[model samples]
Target: MLFLTIYPKLHVVFALVSTHMADEDATTTKLRDRSHIDNTLRLTTAEPTPEFSAALKKLQNIYHSAIKPLETAYKYNELRTHEVTDGEITSKPMVLFLGPWSVGKSSMINYLLGIHDTPQQLYTGAEPTTSEYTVVMHGEKSRTVEGIVMAADNSRSFSPLEKFGQGFLERLVGIEMPHKLLERVTLVDTPGIIENRKQQERGYPYSEVCQWFIDRADLIFLMFDPTKLDVGGELATLFKQMKGRESQIRIILNKADNLATQDLMRVYGALFWSMAPLINATEPPRVYVSSFWPSEYAADTNRQLFIQEEVSLLEDLNQVIENQLENKIAFIRQHAIRVRIHALLVDRYLHTYHEKLGWFSDPHEVFEDIVSDPDKFYIFKSILAKTNVSKFDLPDKEAYQDFFGINPPSGFKQLSSHCSWTSGCLIDNIEKVISVELPALLSSLGKKETPPPAKATPAPPPPLPETKPKNRWRKD
Candidate 1:
């Protein structure tokens, strides 16, 4: 300690345990202790000279000797066990209704679905509302609740997951008929990520939970009561993690029924500009304040007039919804393209795995490892450019015959034979998407649909270099 203190140049070491590390036997224990000591030494010791650094490196080897039997592990498990994803799973994309508590996440959900139903047997007001992560799936088969359930609404501790249930919120409802807008997507009603003393006590910000959803979400409508929008820090994290992460995560400046029009414009302008940097927008950030609230005291004295404003706002809302829908479809299409590219990628480098790679675990584990590597996308992009694929545009239908098989089923053959078909589909889903599904969705977000961009044909590649006889090939 004294040597470290006296010589600013010295390198010293120390060790600390990682509660998250999975392999902690005598070997892992020793390695972690060594890591702490090494970091301590690096912090101390007489100014780290080339010789001291080498000595420190040797000490690390001794500390982790126990892991030698596990030939594949490089170090701790936290760095290794976590999943990195570049594609969607079978799960439907999540649509979260997020905001500070009492800003009406539940009410908005009800309004969006146009329902008055709540949990069963409990008075509508008594049942838990949006106190946990409530997932709504269809309920055509002898369901209990007409559509909503508030049976369980509690926070789950997250230092590590508690026994699946003890502290977590549970979903109690099966969705019935829904607001037309929800027809194509799964709706996730997240427990308020703020002011739940129980959640914050568990050592994670509610914001992180919200972020996890945004990270996977194909469409996100982030609600905000203008009053709390100024709250800082977490918004930055939210923006950093989600800004343009998906084009559909739009800010729903909710309860616009609260602000004066002139004041609303002034404040919203400032707030939008402030958050603009967090989103990947070349234009200023876009937001829609809803005077959708029936009351008058809040902002947007114009909301009660939603009836009067219906014709105009409806037209406007349709355009917005279309834009958001386009973004959502585009995000999913891009994800599909990535999976195709990754399939091509693994095929190109299958030899690196050990000779006896287990069919069940090896493919997934290797896929996880490769995707987690930060450079994975860069490599994937290079491969995609070579393969002639684009996330925004599907490859030509001809590209799929060898992929899907030279002889597909009759149904698929019909699809493939379309002169304009691509990747086994009738046509690129997104192009038709703009004219169909997107109009309603973007209308909800206040974006107008411009005509889709005209498709272009690629020019043929330059003729290949002419070959010459080897004996006479030299240029004069």
Candidate 2:
């Protein structure tokens, strides 16, 4: 409201005084400067008239009004004494471990999650302990006795994911952290894509959830029990649902602890060739052999040694999870890139104005310049309307491909180029998007903000206040 009141009162200088000194091409150059705007509409900064004096005074006062409060707010936030600890998602991901009912999904999850008593049967029985999606977030480790809402009907019912997203995106943007994999990548444990027959016949309640998630999932760790590794039927159908898209889709050979040494080799080879027709896997899925239930022989182990090495996983703590962080960081780096692009011209035009205007000059003059180019301002508004801040996701594979047409790289160079993709790409993208929108912004400014050229009768300057010449040597 304040900006609106002040903007019209100020003037857009055509700098007529400098025209006589400029070269012959000055007229052509000034006219050709429309590269920034396809249609250049000139509004002569007419010589000051009687009414101009009051408007100039009010416009100058607008600058006077804006400075102090903005300065005070900046100082208050910068000098805070205590800083809170906020790096939860970066340390532990909100991993959602999901799979078929009997695939040892919870068993390996508990192992990786480090929730165990070490061989006295931590999970009394491991026959798919989690049938519904669950989100396990960061909490005090001492209390492995944490909160767990094991199952829910509505997919978006759980609120932890929402809060986690808010905190994670905020941290990622605030830190400008380089690690791109993910700081707030929530590990969502979803129901497995069951056999297509089950989806067709009984109509698995969550197949819709599965498809929706696959379309939006950051990474999918598909579990293929060793027994079914050689058979491509189930795997192929799941692959069909989420194929061609790039990033993370890992195949885990669960229940490898159930397979024999030679059979394990056979299943691995067979699954690779069998599924080659369906899933375009860069690498064969990650295969792990281990029981969700601890082995019988490990039952007699001493508590301290077992707890130190296996239960608490304290011995090789850093080494165990160090490699995974790289993947997670890559996801978040992408998010920062989008936020940076939110407005390209607004950032550049304002900065350029500030650089020229300098200190002691008002900053509102910079935005006033934006409103000055009502054409440009309209262009920016049109482009911004197309973009929604909520939709940019670096970690989720499908959004990159479908929403914005960016997909994960198949090779390490693809990763490297993307990781180092210029800070200016967002701006470049906006420039391209708004080229079509420039005329709109320009037309708007022309109507609401830009002024028409001077009229045929040039207006005379308003007279200054009159004062009688002081008598010589008069001092009060």
Candidate 3:
């Protein structure tokens, strides 16, 4: 009996040891992979155009000096920080290709990269071939990297995807190619949407991952072929999520050369009819019909259609680089609006708290009383503590002091001046940065005029003096 117990315990210990060894090995591999990816990113990152570089710098300055300070003050740091980083505005435009498996997504990519004559840079087949999301970017030499490397590269923007679970981590692939086209655009090819119930049960957060990409992609190509014209299941869900991004989405009807004119029209009609409800748009998305690569079965008429469609798609993609600054400005403007609203609420709270305490009646007397006995202001602190500010939207208390021009009381003069200055400066900064300057910059870049910002109402006039006698008990 003693021997049996000892043997089982020994076995358990050995199993634990083996698992630890495996974990260590995995960690070591991930570190090595991360180093390799970082080096590759350094080599592949292209220099931004002068116009884009200048715009990015101006935006970064505004973010760090104005927006970031306000957000840090109100504790709203979590709001849209991912969209603009020091380097994000200058990074290359991302183009994402989303579609069902074997819909010629990869083949079209190969053709664009001029790798069609060489061994396929991306795996293509009639059945599902790509089992991972592949990100192809410019490099001096061709290389393949794993997802961990992407997470490790701080210069790249994919770190957020790491939270999608290990399944997603395991299924991400990064391809570095020397194609000239990649210098202007970063292309992402996702694993075709899985329709099988059993496959979907594998716990990959497909829709969530796709939504992340959609949020960052400057242009999204939703590819379809004759074989899979109807969108359903996960694909339909993905389309529904893309409702507001219609301007960024382009529907590509691929492999049209395989059908005759009559058959092609039927397929086109079928696709449009089926996708109408799924897209849920005022007008149908632009559908670019093309046979991206030469097909042995393609007819002369099909070839003509492919040429026209391919030219249009390429032209649209080329315009993305020029529009990068415009996109960044738009992103910043949206976030700025949110910050302004948050500041407004914080200012309102401060104003109300002061009014309730009757501090506005005789500011000098109130300041003297509070300074003489700091403990007497416990109600003010308590009110702030009890306020139901959302954790995500909370502003910094110190920021409120700065906005209101309240310096820590060195003497009586500073204390008395508190609440004397209105929050007009904060409001003015928001309007100037987001409304006036941003719109002017956009127009200078020859981009369309952004809608004018809603005019901010000035802070309510300070409360009128009360004739009632003061309550002395509240004052220490």
* Predicted structure with the largest lDDT when compared to the true one: 3
Error of 3 at 67 (Å): 2.5
Better lDDT candidate (2, 3): 3
lDDT agreement with native, every candidate: 0.40, 0.36, 0.64
Provide the lDDT at 46 for model 1.
Answer: 19
Per-residue lDDT for 1-476 in model 2, tens only? 57645664442122222322331232234110111110111112322233333332332232223221222222211212111111321234333344555465555444443343433112323233443454434332222211222111122223222223332222111111211122223345554435544544422334444554464444565666666443435555667767643334555555554556578778878766776777665755433333332322133333222222231211112222222333323332222233323223234333444455767776566545544453444534443455543333212322222312221111112111222244323334333323433223223322332234645544332221244322221122
User: Superposing all C-alpha atoms, what RMSD in Å does each candidate have to the true structure?
Assistant: 26.8, 35.2, 20.4
User: Alpha-carbon error at 442 in model 3, in Å?
Assistant: 1.0
Best by TM-score: 3
TM-score of 3: 0.65
Better of 2 and 3 by TM-score: 3
Query: In angstroms, how far off is 54's CA in candidate 3?
Result: 1.9
Model 1 regions more than 4 Å off: 1-95, 116-129, 136-138, 141-186, 195-212, 215-218, 294-300, 303-332, 352-385, 389-476
Candidate 2 lDDT (Cα, whole model)?
0.36
Poorest 10 consecutive residues of model 1 by lDDT?
31-40
